[model samples]
Target chain A: MTQVIDVYDPSDPRLDDFRDLNSIDRRPDLPSGKGLVIAEGVLVVQRMLASRFEPRGFLGTDRRLGELSDDLERTEAPFYRASAEVMADVIGFHLNRGVLAAAPRPPELSISQVIEGARTIAVLEGVNDHENLGSVFRNAAGLGVDTVVFGLGCADPLYRRAVRVSMGHALLVPYAWANSWPGDIELLRDNGFRVLAMTPNPEAQTLATAMEGLARDRVAILVGAEGPGLHARTMRASDVRVRIPMARGTDSLNVATAAALAFYERARR
Target chain B: MTQVIDVYDPSDPRLDDFRDLNSIDRRPDLPSGKGLVIAEGVLVVQRMLASRFEPRGFLGTDRRLGELSDDLERTEAPFYRASAEVMADVIGFHLNRGVLAAAPRPPELSISQVIEGARTIAVLEGVNDHENLGSVFRNAAGLGVDTVVFGLGCADPLYRRAVRVSMGHALLVPYAWANSWPGDIELLRDNGFRVLAMTPNPEAQTLATAMEGLARDRVAILVGAEGPGLHARTMRASDVRVRIPMARGTDSLNVATAAALAFYERARR
Candidate 1:
């Protein structure tokens, strides 16, 4: 069971991990300057507890501590209980979520390990926005996408904003960054996965038609940045190009939303 | 042509409509304490110009004024051009978008007018988040949803945040608030629309199957708040309860993303 520690000092050394959160994403001391994964709010905190990311410590109000008591029973981390004002002072701002969990970044999984037995996976390229990256994980988790593979130019899914926007699915969903660019996609193809690239081209097959045809085979749905879309090389590497059949004159849907539509179509069949 | 007035003074009264935008959403004199609809950045500003909301005036950097030169050719509104620092001083913050347009709230449209000739509409209940509301509008427009109807507990669609997040689709797509609660749902049914309520119930029909069955009929997709979902009374009033097939042990998708999947499926066939 976790120990509850009462903290009254706003500048306590033990609370360093939670300080100045707005800039915490940059940690030069760390290898990549990416800070530890931070999860905010009670629901997200609970999700963190359940995921593979082990919590280093927790800083939250007594109310949230009480709410998280059941979930914290299995963890050995200390919970720093502080008044809302003291907690806000430590974090450098008022947080309405009232609870938080910090977890060290774990070594990333290999693409082979993530796609070993995966039937449906999402491959993202140039999806650099944190919120969109987070939403992709949430959509993947909810829509039964077995894995998420980050290709070139993707944001850190463990970033605080991404974790929060993902509703902590960034921790729950298995993801791996591509060690190689379009070459990693070839690995997916070799693993019996049919790569389906999502595009806005009207002439391409619709998501419904594409997914229906590939229902019996393992599938990898590839999506790219909203405005630029998939790189020509990436599109060339794919086995098939698929579109969501958007309304006329409407250019495209949000990247994550379009990805969700593709994921949903794959799951439904 | 728009009259370009170069203002060196930061305290110019002509810029009052675009002043202190961070708090401009709260207008005590307005019915809902919401201020005039605001459009920021170049694309959204152009969209606002093309929308039903007429810009009374604009405050922008000269660069943005030059970019908007073509769009301003048809308008007589004054462009209050200012330096970036002066623009920031008047807006009480850094205006990264470099431009803004303020339009007063027009008269509310009747529900009948919004739903008229609509084949697919989204009826929102208790979805009070401005960002989520905006995303729904953007998704609706991109996915071919004809109109939006707000039933109860919805935020003001014209709020500045909603306008910006909707990518200015809040101005393009038509929406109307229901004067009657669930009773307004009958109005849709009377117009030959099949109201499909979205839920997380495992027993409910999948969105794909449900939407496929209703492809030929007018459809109104009903969504509620993220946490509580549709009220029991509201769900009871719906014609069919449909659910997005989710992976086991996962929570529901974001309100806007879930709505997008449904809208995409409806348009897919």
Candidate 2:
């Protein structure tokens, strides 16, 4: 069982991981800086416990500690219980979610390792928004996509906002950054995965029709940034091009939502 | 053509509609207060021009004014052009979108009017988050959903953040609030619409199988708040229960994204 430590001091050194969250320069989750993986709220902290990224410690109010008591029993990480006022003073802002867990980012899994037994995967390109990146992972997990492969220009899924938006699926879902751009796509094909690139082009086959034919085969759904869509070369490399039938005069759906549709279609079959 | 007025003073009374955007009490777009509809960025501004919520005036940088020149040709509204610094001072923060359009809230549309000639519509309940509400509008517009009906406990779709997030589709698309709660769902059924309520229930039919059978009929996709989902009475009122097939150990997708998948499936057929 995890040890519960009562912490009264707002300036305790042991609470450094949870300190000064809103400080522009000192925020611990900065990728180029502290690079800590932060899991906020009781539910997300629970998810963090179940994920591969093991929490080093926790800082939260007594109510949150009680809520997380069951999940905390299985882990050895110490829970540093603090008063709400002291917690606010330590973290530089009032955190309404009430609990936070900090973890060091583990070494990334290789693309091949993540996709080893995966039947369906989402490959993203230029999805640079942190929230969008998080939502994609959430969707991928919810829609039975086994893995996510980042092609190029995607945002860090482990970013604090992305992790929170993903509801901690960013920690749970197995994902890997592609070492090669469109070149790695060929590797997917070599592994017997048929790549379907999603586009808004009217001439492309609809998602339902395209996904139906590929239901028996291993599939990789390729999505691009909202405006530009998949790069021409990336589309050319795919086995099929699929479009979601859109209403006339409306812009393309948000990147994550678009990807969700593709993932759903794939799962439907 | 709309007249372009160069404003050098940040404190000018004419720019009151665009003042102190970050102030909690003074924010002009609050539904409880001014109830004004705001569109941010050049693209959203163009959408606002095409929408029913006609802009009374615009505040923007010269570059955005240049970008919107073609769209502004038909409008009688004034374009108050200002420098970025002056805009930052007036709005109380730097707005990277570079442009904003403010419109007075038009009178609400009736449920019958919104659902007329609609083959696919989304019914929302208790989805009060502005960004999620906005994304639903964007998704509904993109995926060929003809209209939206608010069942109960929904936020104001005309809120500024929702308008911006929806790419101003909240203004362009037709929506109506329920005069009655679950009682209003009968109106949809009375109109020969098959209402499918979205749920996380494992026993429910998958979205694809459910939507495939109803492709020829008018359908209303009902979604509720993220955590609670549709009320039990609302679900009992629905024609059928439909669920997205999720991967093992994952929670539900974001409410907007789930609704989009249902919309996409309906459109695909």
Candidate 3:
């Protein structure tokens, strides 16, 4: 069982992992410097306890400590109980969630490792928005996408806001970073995955039609950022170019929403 | 046609409609107070111009003015051309979108007016988040949801953030507020809609199966707030309870994402 220690002073050195989270998260050398994955609130903290990430420490109010007691039993990490005021002072803002857990970054899984036995995957390119990145992970988890592969210019999924927005699914879902551009597309193809690149081109095949044909095949759904869609090179590398049949005059859906549609179509058994 | 008037001063009375947007929007008596709908960025501004919400005035830099020149030709609103600095001073922040449009909220459409000939509509209950409300509009417009009906506890869709997040679709799409929540659902059924309430219940019919069966009928998708889901009374009144078939262990997708899946499934033909 985890130990609960009362802490009054906001400047306690032992609570450094959970201090000035707003500033620390925005620092230029993030995920490389301290690289701590912070999970906030009762739900996310419980999810962190269940994830592969081992907690380094936890800080929260007494009520949160009680709420997290069952999940805390699985970890040896100490829970530093503090007043809500002290938490606000340390984190540089009032977090309504009341409880927070900090975990150090674990080694990332390779593309090969994450894609193993995965029948459906999402590959992202230039999806640099953190909220969208989180939503993609959340959608992937809910809609049966087995893995995610980041191609280029994608935001860090472990960013505090991303993780919180994802409701902690970023910790649960398996994802990997692609070292090569379209070259990685070949690796997925070699592994028996038919890659479908999403686009707004009206001439392209509709998502429903494409997904129906590939329902029996291992599939990879490729998505890009909202405005400037998939790079032509990446589009050319895919096995089939697909488009969501959209209403007239509207250009495209949000990147994450588009990805969710693709995932839904793939999983619509 | 829009007439450009250069104003170097940030305190011009003509620009009052665009002042301190962030603070004014949060005021308790807002929408009902100033009752102005603000549209930011070129695309959204253009959308506002095309929409029924006529632009009262425009505050923008020269670049945005030039970009909106063609669209502004139809409007008689004065374009208050200002430097980026002056624009920032007036609006209380630096808007990278460089342009802003303010329009008076027109009289809201009624349930009968908005759903006059709708084939697919989204009914939202307790969806109070502005961002999610906006995403719903964007997804609805893209996926052929003809109209939206607000049941209860939904945030104002014309709120500034909602308009921006919806890519101005909140302005473009026809939406109405239901004075009687689950009662208004009867009006939809009277108008030939088959109400489908979305739930995470494993025993509920899958969205694909439900939607496929109702493909020939008018469909109304009911979604509640993220956690509480549809109220019991609302669920009992619906024609069918449908669920997106999710991966095991995951509970739900974002509210807007769930709505989008329903819309996509309905429009999958």
Candidate 4:
């Protein structure tokens, strides 16, 4: 069971991991990243506990602590109970979520390991927005996309906002960054996966028609950033180019929403 | 042609409509609301010009003036051109989008007016988040959802953030609020529309199966807030309860994304 520690001091050294988090979360690539994954809210903390992430410690109001008591039983981490005022002073701002859990990021899963026995995966390129990345994971998990593969210019899925926005699906859904982007497209192909690139080209096959044809085969749905879609090279490398069949004269949908459509089509089977 | 008035004063009264917009936009429901709609950036300003909303005036830098000259040719409103610094001072922050257009809220469109000749429409209930509402508009425009109806507990779609987030689609796409909640759903039914409510209930027919059966019918996709979906009464009033086939153990998709999936399925024709 987790140890309960009463913390009154806002500047306590033990609370350093959760201190002034907005700036820290903004710069995960910084030298002093602390390499920690933070989960906010009682529900997300519970998801962290159920996932492979091991919470190093927790700081939250008594209310949230009580809500998470059942989930905390399996962890040996200390639960630092603090008043909301003290917690806000420590974290540099008020958090409405009432609870926070910090866990060190484990070594990333290898593409081979994450894709093992996976039937449907989402491959993202230049999807650098954290909210979109988080939404992709949420959509993926909700629509049965088995894995998420990041190619180029993708933000850290473990970034604080990403994890929070994903409702902790970022921690639960297995993902891996590509060592070689467009080249790795072949790796998926070699693994018996048909890489379907998402495009806005009217001539491209609609998601419905494409997914229906590939229903019996393993599929990798590739989506790029909203404005500048899949790179020319990336599109050429894909097995099929698929579109959402947008209305005439309308711009493309948000990247995450578009990805959800692709995932829903794949899951419709 | 728009008359270009060069303004150098930051405290000028002409700029009052664009003053402290962040705070004003935060509480559009406040009694002090100026009863005006704001369009930011070059693209949104253009959309407002093309939309039913008529800009009373424009505030922009000379650079944006040059960009919008073509669109401004259609309007006689004065373009208050100012330097970026003066523009920032008037707006109480640096205006990155480089342009603003303020339009008085016109009379609300009637349900019959918006749903005229519509094949697909989105009826929202309890979706109070401005971003979600904006996304629904953008998705609706992109995926051919012809009109939007607000049933109950929805936020003001003309709030500045909603206008900006929708990429001005809030101005382009037609929407009407339900003066009488679930009762107003009948307005759609009387117009030969099949109302399909989006639910997470596993027993509900999947979007594919439901949409496929109603291909020849005008469809109204009904969505509620993320957590507390369509009220039991609203669901009972719906012609058909439809669900996106979500993966096991996952929650519902974001309200806008789910709406997008329904729109995509309906537009896949």
Candidate 5:
């Protein structure tokens, strides 16, 4: 069972991990940084408990503690219960969610480990927007994409806003950053996965047609940044180029949305 | 030809319509609101010129003015040229978009007016989030959705954030607010549209099956708020209940993304 500590003061040293979260999350220390992974609200905290990232402690209102009590039973961490006002003073803002869980960042997973046994995966390059990254994870989870492999120029999926925007799927979904970019394409090919790059080139086959051809094979849906799209080297490295049929004069869909469409199409097969 | 008015002062009375944009957009004066529809950035400004929303004036740097000179030739509105710093001082923020165009809200189009000659439409209910609404517009534009019809509990599509998120497609794609909610659905039926309501229920026919049946017919893709889907009354009113085949243990896609998939399915035929 988890321990419950009733705390009255906002400035208590014990609450430091949960303090000024906005700044800490915005400019997270990196390169051997020991920044904590935070999950907000009852639902996400519950997910955090179930995820591989183990929480060291929790801070929440008595009501949230009650809501999370059954989940808390699975962890030995302490729940620092406090009032809404105290939480606001501690976090430097009013947190309507009323609960938070913080866990130490775990060791990064390897690309091979993430891709093992994955029949359908999403490979992302230059998707630097956090909200877009989060949405991609949420979409990947919902659409049955088995794994997410990041190439380069991607934001940290554990950023508070990414986590929040993804409805906490960033925690549940398995993902790994590539040690080497377009070179990593060889690893996927060696695993017998067809790396299909998503592009706006009209000459490219429609997503449905491409997926239909690859229905019986392992597939990787490759997506890039919003405006610049996939670098030419990465595009040439792909086994096939797929495009969502767009209306005349309209630009491509948001990268996350485009990724979702490809993921949806791949799952439909 | 459009006229050019050079202004060196940051507090020019002529710039009142574009002043303190963030605050003005946050708490929009509605109903009697003579507030203008703002188009930020050069591309959006060009779109606003082409849209029914007529700009009363323009604001931009000299560089942006040169870029937009060709598009501005069609408009009679005076281009209020100013430096980036002066533009920032007037707008209360550093808008990197570098240009803005403000147009008085045009009289709303009736449901019949927007639906005329349209083949595919999106009907939304209780989708109050501005970003979602904008994404719907952007997706609709890209996926060949012809019109958007709003049900009750929807936000203003012309809101600044919605316009920005839509990439100004909110201005290009025609949308209408229903005088009555589920009641307006009948209007669509009478217009020869096969109304297909999007639902998360596993029992609902998948989007592919439903779209296959309606390949040669006019269709309306109906969506509701994210968590609570289409109201039962509205669901009952739709001709076919359709759902994106989501993976097990997952909820629904973002309403806009769902709509895009439905639109893509429709256009694929």
Candidate 6:
């Protein structure tokens, strides 16, 4: 059973892992900093406990402790119980969710490791926004995408905001950063994955048509940043180009939204 | 041609419509308050110009003025050109978009007005989050949804954040608040529309199957809030309850994303 330690001092050294969360220089989640993966809220905390990112400790109110008492039985990590006031003073904000869990980020998976046994995967380029990255993971997890491979310019998926926005699916989804931009395209091909790049070009085949033809194949969907879509070299390297059939006079959909449509279309059967 | 007045002072009374934008109580876009509509960035401002929310005035840097000069020819609203520093003082933050447009709230359109010639519409319930509401409008605009009808517990679509997040489609896409609750669902049926409610129930028919049958009919895709979805009474009123095919152990998709899938499926033909 996990030990419960009641903490009254807002400045206790033991709470350092959960402190100054919004501080730009001191936030523990920064990859260059402590690299801690922080999970906020009850649902996300529960998800963190289930993910590979094992919890180092927990800081939450007594009410939250009782709520999580059943799940806490599985972890040996200590729980620091504090009043909401003390927690607000320690973490630099009043958290409505009433609970938090901090975990050290585990080693990242390789492209080959994440794609093993995967039938559908999402390859992202320049999705630098943490929220967008989080949404993509949530969509991928819910829509049957087995893995995620990051191309160039993607943001860190383990960032605290990303994890929180992903409803903690960022911790559960298997993902990897590609060492070689377009070169990794050949690696996926070697593994029998057909790469389809998502574009807004009206001349490109619609997503429905592209996805329908590849229903029997191991498919990889490549999505770029919202405005400056896939780089020319990356576009040329893909096996096929696909477009979402959009209404006239509108720009492309949000990158995450576009990815969700592709994932849904691929999984429709 | 629109008048361009060079202003060096940040406290000018003429710029009051664009002042203290981040102040909760003083924000000009508050419905019960100023009831003003605000559009940020050059793209959204240009969209506001083309929308029905006639601009009362604009406050932006000289660079944005040059970018918008061609679009300004259609309106007589004065553009208050100031330095970035002065504009920042007036707006309480340094807006990277470098431009802002303020317009008085126009009269509300009735359900009859928005649905007159519409073939596909989205009906929202308890979607009070401004960003989600905005995203629904953005997705609807891009997916051929002609109108939007609000059921209950919805936030003001004209809220500044909603307009910005919607890419100013809140101003372009016509929407109306239903004077009745699910009662207006009958109004839609009377006008030859089939209502489909998005739910996460496995027992519900999949979106593609439901949409395939409704392709030849006028459709109204009904979506509820994320957690506590459509009320039981509201669900009963819907013509069909449809769900997105999701992987096990996952919850429903975001309200806006689910709406997008329905809209996309309906327009896929």
Output the TM-score of candidate 4: 0.96
- Candidate 1: lDDT of B231? 96
TM-scores of all predicted structures = 0.95, 0.95, 0.97, 0.96, 0.98, 0.97
Backbone collisions counted per model: 0, 0, 0, 0, 0, 0
Better of 1 and 4 by DockQ: 4
Q: Residue A113, candidate 5: how far off, in angstroms?
A: 0.1
| Model 1 misplacement above 4 A | A30-32, B29-33
The better-scoring model by TM-score among 1 and 4 is 4
Off by over 4 Å in 3: A26-31, B26-31
Candidate 3 structure quality by residue, lDDT tens digits, A175-266? 99998998999999999999999999988999888988987999999998999999999999999999999998899999999999999888
lDDT string for model 2 (B1-269, tens) is 89999999999989888887754224534564655677889989888888888899999999999999999998999999999999999989999999988887787899999999988899999999989999999998988989999988898888778887898899888999989889999999999999999999999998889998997899999999999999999999999999988888886889999888888878876
Task: Give TM-score values for chain A, per-prediction.
Answer: 0.98, 0.95, 0.97, 0.97, 0.97, 0.96
> Native-vs-model 6 lDDT?
0.91
Q: How much is the TM-score of the A chain of model 5?
A: 0.97
**Per-residue alpha-carbon lDDT of model 3 for B70-174, expressed as tens digits?**
999999989999999999999998999999998877888999999988899999999999999999999999999999999989998988999999999999899
- On the 0 to 100 scale, the lDDT of residue B26 in model 2 is 42
Which is the winner by DockQ between candidate 3 and candidate 5? 3
Candidate 4 deviant stretches above 4 angstroms: A26-35, B26-35
Put down candidate 2 lDDT per residue, A1-269, tens digits, no spaces: 88999999998999988877764224534565645789999889999999999999999989999999889998888999999899999988889999999888788999899999999999999999989999998998888888999998998888888899999999988999999889999999999999999998999998888988988999999999998999999999999999988899986899999888888878876
Candidate with top DockQ is 3
- Can you write out model 6's per-residue Cα lDDT over A182-202, one digit (the tens) per residue? 899999999999999999988
Q: Each candidate's DockQ score against the native complex?
A: 0.83, 0.84, 0.92, 0.90, 0.81, 0.88
Candidate 1, residues A1-269: lDDT per residue as tens digits?
89999999999999998999898898878776779889999999999989889999999999999999899998999999999999889988999999988888888899999998899999999999999999999999999998999999999899899999999998998998899999999999999999999998888998888888998999999999999999999999999999887776567778889999888888887
Candidate 1 residue-wise lDDT, B1-269, digit = tens? 89989998988888888888888988887775669889999999999989899998898989999899999987888999899999989999997999999888888899899988899999999999999999999999999999999988999898889988899999999999998999999989999999999999989998888998998999999999999999999999999999988898798899999999889889887
